[model samples]
Target: MTYLASPSTLFGRLINRTQYADLPWSNILAINFLRGRLNRLSANLPNLIEELSDENLQSAWKVLQPLYYDLYMLRAIQESKQIVQPGETLTREEALRLLHFP
Candidate 1:
């Protein structure tokens, strides 16, 4: 039997083994790839929904996949350190108060 770790764990292992210097991905290419993939996936969703039966196991599997991918992308962004998560948000007044605190 094969045991699979959570997506975050998988990503951690992958990044640790991967050499960023050898990566072919750039911001522009990544943006374009995501845009193209989103458009294609959006167009296909209706067809996919139509082809799958609600009572079938595949229907529930399809439902979980999108949620998993969303969580995966969010985790990637948070791990990158370039983006902030919602819990990190500070009110404008709170921010100014912190800046001026003696």
Candidate 2:
């Protein structure tokens, strides 16, 4: 038989693990960063789609390939609890590297 933890149980475990009061603030900042990227993409993608030129395609690829890796990172975050070393903190550049940002 297979066993699966419910979402609330998983969330509870996460809540229990975190001891920082600033975690929510960090989460909000991350969400805003992603939201800004998404907004820019929404604003720009239509122009690329309508134009369909070589330069525009290249531009779109440059903008999107990192986003593709970021999506993978999001999945990894959901499924893996081993992304970071124990008690080791990541710098902003290191985080960008994990996203495969160019």
Candidate 3:
């Protein structure tokens, strides 16, 4: 019987051999592309919030909370030199303000 190696072990071995410079440009390009899409989504969020029903508003907030957090982290990572400022992180209240829900 053949035993398969754990995926994490394989992934770790692969990562050990890889350098940041060896990464593909397509991966960087995709991240930049996603950043732009997130920007557009954030710009339109206020208007989108206005169109939701009471029940759906809660659902929208639930969905947006994580998305906004991820966007904030991505922006912070892109802008900061591996040290993100405390102010760069988004609070729940700040997120609601940005969405124009309050």
Higher lDDT: candidate 1 or 3?
A: 3
Candidate 2 global CA lDDT score: 0.59
Q: Each model's TM-score?
A: 0.32, 0.29, 0.41
Listed per candidate, the RMSD to the true structure in angstroms reads 12.7, 14.2, 17.7
Provide the overall lDDT of each model, using Cα atoms, as 2-decimal numbers: 0.59, 0.59, 0.60
Looking at model 3, residue 46 earns an lDDT score of 67
In model 1, state the lDDT of residue 11.
Answer: 38
What digit string (tens of lDDT, one per residue) describes model 3 on residues 1-102?
111323233233222213556768777566556666665676676687778898988876787778667866765666685687778778998898989965
> Candidate 3, residue 70: CA error in Å?
11
**TM-score between candidate 2 and the true structure:** 0.29
Candidate 2 per-residue lDDT, tens place, 1-102, comes to 111333333234233214555567667566556666655665575665777978867887798778667866766786666666665777888988988975
Residue 10, candidate 2: how far off, in angstroms?
19
Best by lDDT: 3
Per-residue lDDT tens digits for candidate 1, residues 1-102, read 111234334434233214564655675467456566665676566677677666864667677778777876876866766677666878899999999994
User: Which regions of candidate 1 are displaced past 4 Å?
Assistant: 1-25, 57-102
